[model samples]
Target chain A: MPIPSPTVITAATLDLRGRPVFVRSTGTTDGPALILLHGLPTSSWLWRRCLPDLAEALPGWRIIAPDLPGYGRSAPRPGAGPRHLGGWLHALLTTLGVDRFALVGHDLGGLVALTDAVARTGRLGGTPHPARTGGPQLERLLLLNTTIYPAPLLVLGLLPSIVPPFADLSLVWLGRGGAARDDDRRKGYVVGMRQLLAPGTVVEAVEWAEYARPYGPIAGWREARRSLRALAWQAPFVLRCLAHLGDLTLPTRLIWSRHDPFFPLAVAERLRRAIPGAEPMIHIIEGAAHFPQEDQPAEVARLIAEFLREPR
Target chain B: MPTHTPVRYVLTSHVEEHGGRPAAATHAEIFEQVALADSFGFDALWLAEHHFGAQAGMVSQPLLVALAAATRTRRINVGTSLIVLPLHHPLMLAEQLSTLNLLTEGRLSIGFGSGSAPFEFAGFDAPFDGERRHPRFREALEVIERAWTGEPFSHEGTNFQIGEVRLVPRPTRPLREFAWLGAMSEQTAAMAGEFGYGLQLPRGQSADHYAAPIGAFRAALRDTWGPDAPERLAIARCVYVGTDDETAIAEAGPSIRRFYEHSKGYDKTKPTPAAPELIERLHFIVGGPEKCAREIAAFVAATGISHLSIQPIWEGLEHGQAIASLRRFGAEVMPRAEALIGAERAAGVAGQD
Candidate 1:
């Protein structure tokens, strides 16, 4: 007997604090909620596989994957960096009526989730914010292949600080090139994205197209450039949030791909040690690169489910 | 026109001792047999889960064995003849099976049973009382099904209290599509039907003994899921095919007797009646191709089973002999049996028309 494919995924745009936030969601809305945040250059579409499977695995729970502001279908908040994005996420969740839920983030999204978690802990600069009082409570936090401490070699971290104009020009070139005329350039961009996955992992052409779709337009490149530039300014605040990670009391699990070139396993190790009660919470998935969700979605899903199901 | 329900032949194994060989050797032979079965176009290969006594069976985790078998052969669906559900946590089981499903690219089937062995439950430190066991099994099944839905669910049951949690990686497909309920009682068979799962009849039982459960299962299935609901009833039987009846008996008779003797020895409470004729009639299907085919057709005709899960290898049987038996069964017995079944069904349809 063959297993049936997952439920139909519903995509919608929500007006969060007057910004059009594009979201892809599945499962029942009334169940316990799980929100998925995708990393840089990718949209909620990063969780195309994870959403349906996670929703199916966790019936009754609402599984929401949102294109973070400035990425995918969401309109870019011109000056919003990681900190601002984190605040925006809280507002988005609050607007969606998700009072309490688990959060999973990858890459830049991980930084955002961590920022949100730190802010919620009332440990950000040792001062409690108003949002901490009545905001959506994070039941659990799962980070994948993301970094907290700034590394000069960090692609997202380095792009804005070192070569902002060059990065901007490259994005424009990659975005503006027509599909038929610049097939090689589009293929090169897809190949670059494929490099983020484990070597030899066969990603279908159509899937690559979905990943590249957002970046096909000038708006996508403009949003990507803005996010990159904003990260350079958000560095100090993100580091400060990182300093207060020890104060976080919520359950945290770190899943890192062993061969991630940008953020190595050492980054996960550091975060694991910094967070309270997270000593035994780190899992290293082998045979995967930066995008473990794409390289090994099953393992990623298993780890997430296992960690979430663990008694709080 | 009435359509014929084609009987699917699946090879099953307990991974039992073969001539005092090591457990590793037995596992290797099972994989080899699995490859052979796959090559011969068997519908699936099911492995039984057992614990404690090494001589009784080596397989404690049928899913792991199934995974190994799945990797070794392509196209053949691998399954647990029955995983002892009450002993393991349902969430963990769901996760592992889901991983197996993904790894195998969805060539996986599962048979779940509330195991009968008291010692097996004792080893796992689980409750063995029928009163507790039955409910726990039922609750676990409920949890597993809910987990497969990839939806967040909370369960506060008699045996388990699960907080809001969902199964990860979600199953490639709904696990129920490939799930079977291994029923030892008419009540369980009815429950399998009520749940809309396939029903797997146990081995070493008479056709008369199985009739009630089969009837209950089909009736419940029709009543609950409508008449169009698939009657995926599978029966496990000891089957061996040879060039002639004399050759078949000479090769398989002693091993067949020893198999029953070992089974009786394990329980001690059950009668150790290993009369060759009675065993031949009820348990073993050892004969030449023609005879094996005829018996298989008759059994299918009588029981109305959609699948036949055959144990071609037994304790003390040579691995080569088992392979040869499987070869003959695949090349001769299977096609002949299928032809006979088709003819019988066609005749029945003609009579109706």
Candidate 2:
């Protein structure tokens, strides 16, 4: 059934850990909350494809998505790396009075969510705790194309770049990449997404343009580059996130893309067992790759709706 | 995975004799500057190589001055900005550098340039016309390197004719001295790359003007040298960091304007057209700590050059004030700028697919 367009979506910049973090929210005023987070080379735009379906299928379920500090229109706070953003995420949720919510994370966002969960759980004595006391309550956890094992490519690519002499070369490296003109950068991002998604995926030009805004003429690209380099340079935070990989004990689900190159089906299966007490039910979206949310949005949306209705 | 070479914080001394300080006091002050810089972890310290400029405390005998400096400072690298290659015989200069290297434990570097002042060329009985200076400078560099090898070699190039003669005392690290060419034009910059020589860009040019030379060097590196030939890519800047922006400008403004106005002996060119537009683009990274960090980060982001050699003293700015600026940059500005750059780089990689 085609989802109705009665859903309301609005955007705002909220004070998040002292940086102006841009947020996109949906659903009625008083409703169960769900916070969606995106991964690399994308912003809140990643959630646009699935929001209509989610809002129509589950009315009154508040959906909140933020363009992680430095990702989208958010004013990047100081040092928004992997170790840092999760704390900012917690601060954002606390500021919104979002004490309890279902958390869904993809790629780096997934790692950040898991970090947030472990941190909150660690603070609340590992049990169902009152929200007013402290920290957000994670009712259910969901992972998609998320980083679990420190994949050699991800870990190794950033390793030497953070070391002393090489660490100093980060600006040179970023400058080279950022030198691409705005149009060329836009085209590059689209070409990159094609390699990451299912082959022959027809991404509309308008959609691509929306994603390309950050890599623009001057100010936008500089802002994006500054924010991005800050996160990539945080090696210590990457280590901390990797250390807490096995602590997600919430009622969890892992819906993965069948052809995902970054995290294969086998990796997803391993994650089912790796989330300590998760015993996650894994669903595979067939016509997708690293980004099932984009390549097969309908299937992803259906899987999410079904998962939300499951008996706890 | 990638790693970087060490980014150097070199100190440049124009040796402007502030307020009639005795020449001995000025020389002592230069040595004291080197000692202070060595303690603060500066990569290399250099005094300008100007001659016949009585007002400027130019170190005409650079190797001798460096030899003297090496005695007081344990670690700071000592060198001269430009030692007019045509003024001295290449073999004798090579021999002196070899001896200085031995004395300094291989801590000496030399920046060789074709003398620009026609009068200085006339004083040395060398040609004052265009093209004559550079060919002599270039040929001298070639002969110097060939002679330093300590192997019997004969060179029969124009302006130089030497028999198969090997020196008795060779340099400790022959052919290892950091030899750079001061590139003021595209040809020079590209030549620096093609000949595998380090580049010392003329001081005070804005970042926007650096692209052509950097690009030219890179192209030469790829096509001719097969390496980014510069042993170090050094650019000079005038910097002043204070507790705040207004104060920094207020403190550094007059001397800087004086530098543009009267410091003609520092560079061979007509005193920099420090016109209103040019003055607006002064190489002074003048501001408070955070503001300086932001400006410097932007500069690095624009130009990927590695070594930044800064002149903190001169044109009536006192020695004590120069020390404060250096300390502020070394202890406060650089660290904060590094943190900002690191975070920006980290965020950039994370944002990439």
Candidate 3:
């Protein structure tokens, strides 16, 4: 008859320009906001394992996990692009009455977080310094397994894939799971998952369904297509964000996976070196691939919470 | 002897399979108990790892349990009571511990055992004989320590051959891994002391059995590290306090006996003294709160080991039963135990004068 009490996580939605943003939150309402963002093909649920611990670690902080548009429960708009994604997220947070908050983002979510920071700093093509250029005061930031700045060749390859015919084919081939020769429809998603998840780790069927659900339909694929196109065109803007990365004048820690397929340890090391700050500790998560957040949530949460709690 | 050191309490849990009870249920209870221990301000919490036994222990992976406890509690140090190190690849173990250390904010402590169960070792396809175990544990410990250094190193021992390997996501502090060894004899204790590991001693042994190893370790520690250094040793005891001594015996004796016998069938490490006289002599704290406090205080004074780990969960001990005793120990026993130890210290100081 003995069982641990369930953690109290409230699922709610916010209206941003007529589109609803799905969010799961915990801790006190008036506490300092801590926004958690998830990467592509995964939604706010990816942060599920870390949320409870995060809530435990920072009792006075509000942990907000929102499903970006077209990801989980959020409705994707027709014209929403990568540029609009950050704006939409900022608007959603503002609507929630969160003005200043710490941002923790993973993978593509990390890229989105950078864009959001850069846009706020108003340094599209301006001289930037961490101390001088900033809109809202960023209390802290944690970037995981993401590189806002990419090698030109990497971007060049992705650039062609985002073009019309290629983008359409790429959407089918890369979205949900991936393109398959028809053994199992779920196999495409499984293959993608295998690449993302550490070997010897098992994901329950239900959990896989939650991640693959978004890419199951034609509408989902269309939304992914638009998100991709946005990413491809916003290359220059992303580079700008990368340029003014020092505009983030707060304590930041980059937690990266050593074996990440897309952005390996070298990418995180380069980013860590380039990031101008007195308080940046680059930690490499061992034995994890692209999604260390999901692979080792406790370790990921531990590093971030410790950095946040530690005096700078 | 000076009773100046304030005895610190730690909670140890071994979720034994109770009469057809599910393993999952036992695991759930343990997590809750650990969280409560953390909130109650216990100094630390340690876990029991078992494998391939018929309902002896439900938790086979203490590292996984430590990870779970880290998420649940904020301040409590999480450690394994004894991880049978011989069964695992040293590099893999090192990687796991290093990553866990980073996660726990350097609050991770490791305890290694030369595994005693042949079947359990066989399950992992590892060499399980006594002849091989000592060598394996020593070699494995060497590799684990080297891996924590975060430096590219190689080992060319008799058992292992590797070339220029460095662990990634290394421990934050290079060349350091906080560790404990639940060693059984003076030789092992000396090794543990020489290597700067905290020595962990379990209960159910003869009262005299401990002092020898501790003394040997102290001497070895002094020889290796210098006389000014402090020795850290943690002792585990079986404890249950009832309203009165008679009630305590009636309530806890049978369960304690069952626990020892069940243990005897497995874990061929140390022989436990279960005779009534020996049990009393070994000082299992089964009595009223006042008597229990005095016993614990006396034991602390004699041993000079400040850290006390109490096994609240055992074979035939229900979850609620353990909780009741735990509450009484914290609320009633700890304060009195401290007061008694203080009085002893005062008496010693006055006698010296």
Tens-digit lDDT track for model 3 on B180-262?
88877888888777565778888776446789889877776655434544567888898887787777777787777666566
Would you list the rank order by lDDT, best first?
1, 3, 2
Which of the predicted structures, 1 or 2, would earn the higher DockQ when compared with the native?
A: 1
| Preferred candidate (lDDT higher): 2 or 3 | 3
Best-performing candidate as measured by lDDT: 1
- iRMS of candidate 3, one decimal? 15.6
* Model 3 per-residue lDDT tens digits across residues A188-237: 45556666678766778787777767655545655655666666677776
Compute each candidate's TM-score over C-alphas. Answer: 0.54, 0.50, 0.51
In candidate 3 the C-alpha lDDT for residue A116 amounts to 70
TM-score of chain B of each: 0.94, 0.89, 0.91
Q: Which has the higher TM-score value, candidate number 2 or candidate number 3?
A: 3
The per-prediction CA RMSD against the true structure, in angstroms, equals 20.9, 24.4, 21.1
- TM-score top scorer: 1
- Residue range A152-181, candidate 1, lDDT tens digits: 324564564234222334645555545453
lDDT tens readout by residue for model 2, A117-202: 66555542433323435666678888887764554324424553443222323343454545555566556556656677787667
Q: Write the per-residue lDDT of candidate 1 for residues B295-341, one digit (tens) a residue.
A: 89999888888889999887778888999999999899989998999
Evaluate all candidate structures by whole-model CA lDDT and list the values in order.
0.79, 0.69, 0.72
DockQ of each: 0.01, 0.01, 0.01
Please tell me how candidate 3 rates in CAPRI terms.
incorrect
